[model samples]
Target: MNKFDAIVIGAGQAGVPLAKKLAAAGWKTALIEKRAIGGTCINDGCTPTKTMIASARMAYMAGRSDELGIHIPEYRVDFKAIMDRKSTIVKQFREGATKGLEETKNLTVIYGTARFVDPHTLYVDKNDGSFENYTAKKIFINTGCTPFIPDIDGLKEIPYLTSTTLLEIKEVPEHLLIIGAGYIGLEFAQLFRRLGSQVTIVEKSNRLMPKEDDDICTVMSDIFDQDGIRVWTETQVESLSLKLGKVHVKLDGGGKGPASLNCSHVLVASGRTPQTAALGLENTGVVCDEKGFIKVNKRLQTAEQHIYALGDVKGGPAFTHISYNDHLVITENLLNGRHKDISKRMIPYCMFTDPQLGRVGMNESQAKEAGIDYLVASIPMKNVARAIESAETRGLMKAIIDKKSRRILGAAIIGEQGGEIMTVLQMAMMGKITADEIRSGIFAHPLYSESLNNLFMSV
Candidate 1:
């Protein structure tokens, strides 16, 4: 039996940081991962998807060279080269994470699947078929999540692809059918469409990205229609089957009859579920909701006081940065004996589409739902000099402020560099800065971030 001061299960964004902090604070820490280091963000989810999106965006711009007053003879996408570059990026980040762990003298990295043998004991199943027992004072569960594939008939038999397997393919599909209209689905739809694939998206919701603002969804739907990506809203997928190397999907709608779509390949970009099944939570006192997510308090502590849950497992937003913040709160509570709750932090989320969408704090609808008096201000991208100069003058910047206190309630941006510009709004919301402070701030000339200044000025 091996004993440690802390045991971190899963080496994803949350676990890695927590382990490093504990180890650096002079604790004997043991980090366990069933797969590679850096977790899903570096391996299968964010990093790889963003890299592929960059390649797709470049290809799309090349197709519009005529608009830029540059005549290109011909442009061809070397799919293999793009895949190679993405692989290189993932490998580099993975190696860097591994090296960081190795440098931590007080941290021991274990590559295996860890299950709770008891409240304080963990049984590790090593890749080499050997087993080891570890005991620790506290544990952090950061196993993250996996793509949720629906239980459609014949889906398992078909040679369908997911975000995980699709990233590894060197050849592009002739026709790709995406099964969801959330961020993941829309992102891959745009990417494959730009890569010359006839893409069709089927969403059961009334609109794409239903979680986002209605106006933003309408604008993005228009952009998607202009890009030749077919979107079917309020359409239910009844069945999926393979017919002569092509996948056939049957759909049903409220006012319409049954419809079918035949495609060369199908990609499931539906959302993900928390990866908590194999951790053996039953052995511990920790309780999970019906959806298999760990139930935790605002401080992220599970039913077992010493065992904390973070990231997707704790539910709510599943962004990488949120997981990192979870690590900060947990470390502060453990090391500095500070009392900071996870809910107190301002969480911002972004969808990296062509006209990226970002939101922080409460929006107009949310504020009204909460029965709070709020004021709204909006600025179009065309009004910004930088957006006009970039020749990508589309989308809008919207701000929601508390009418009583003049505090920035929430802000949403959908335009060029909207993702980058959201950081400032997030800072204002988190720091509890007022609208006047933002309005008085001087912004640099001819930059997209200037939209923030213009937004508050109008308010």
Candidate 2:
């Protein structure tokens, strides 16, 4: 039996930072990970996908260079080279993470799956034949989540890919059928479409990304339609089958009755669920919600006060940045005994399609649903000088301001560097900058951000 001051169940974004902090604070820590060091971000989620997305974006720009007055007669995409580049960068990041863990004093990195025998006792099933039992005063489960596989007929029997599996694909799929139209689906749909694949997206909801405002969703649908991508919303996938080496997908509902489609590959991007079933939390008396998420308070503490849950495992916003923020909260609690709550934090996220959607604070729909007194203002990218000069005018910038406070409530950007432009609004909201300041603010000429001057002026 082994004992440590702290035991972090997963070496994820939250676990890594928390473990380092615990070790630095003179606590003997055990960081247990069943897989590679970097967890979801470096291995499958952010790093590899973004790197491939970059390659796809460059290919798209080269193909459309005629509009920019730089005509390249032909541009060929080497799918293998793109995959290799992704692999190289992923390797570098994983090695760097591994090095950091090694350098952490009093941090014992273990390769194993940990299950709670009791609240304080953990039985570690190591990769090797040897097994160990560990007890700690403080335990954290940052195991995060996995891509949820929806129960469609004949799904498991066929070679369908998840978001993680699709990243490892070397060949550009001849035809890719995505099962969901959320952020994961849209990003891959655009990336593969740009990589010369015939991409079709099917969403179960009535519209694509129903979480966004109706207008924003409509604009995204139009942009994809213009880009030669087929989108079918209010669609339900009935079953999947293999026909002559192609994936034959039978989808029901939508505008069409029952429909059958054939594709070279099928990628499922429905959603993800917390990874807690195998953690043996049942024996620990820690309660998990109906969706399998470990129930954590605003301070990220579980039913067992000594044990904490962070990141997607606690089932709120599932993003790398959110997990990092979870680390900050947990570290502060452990170090200064402070209760820095994450429930009220301003969460910002971006979807990296061609016309990236950068969002911070409340969208129009949310403010309306909450019955908040808000004012909305918008500016089309076509109205911006930089957008016209760059010939990338396709989306819009929208802001929602609280009427009473005259402060920015939320803003959404769907243009080139949409996330980058949204950050300006996020800072304004953070600093309590009023809507009037943004309206009258003098911004530099000929930049997409300068559209802020016009966006708020119209409000």
For all candidates in order, the CA lDDT equals 0.89, 0.91
TM-score of each: 0.97, 0.98
**Residue 453's C-alpha lDDT in candidate 2?**
86
User: How far is 372's C-alpha from truth in model 1 (Å)?
Assistant: 1.4
Model 1 ranges with Cα > 4 A deviation:
457-459
Write model 1 residue lDDT over 15-45, tens digit each, in one string: 9989998999999999999999999999998
What is the C-alpha lDDT profile of model 2 across 215-264, one tens digit per residue?
99989999999989998888888999998998898989766788889999
Please list all clashing residue pairs in model 1, or write none if there are none: none
Give the Å shift of residue 186 in candidate 1. 1.3
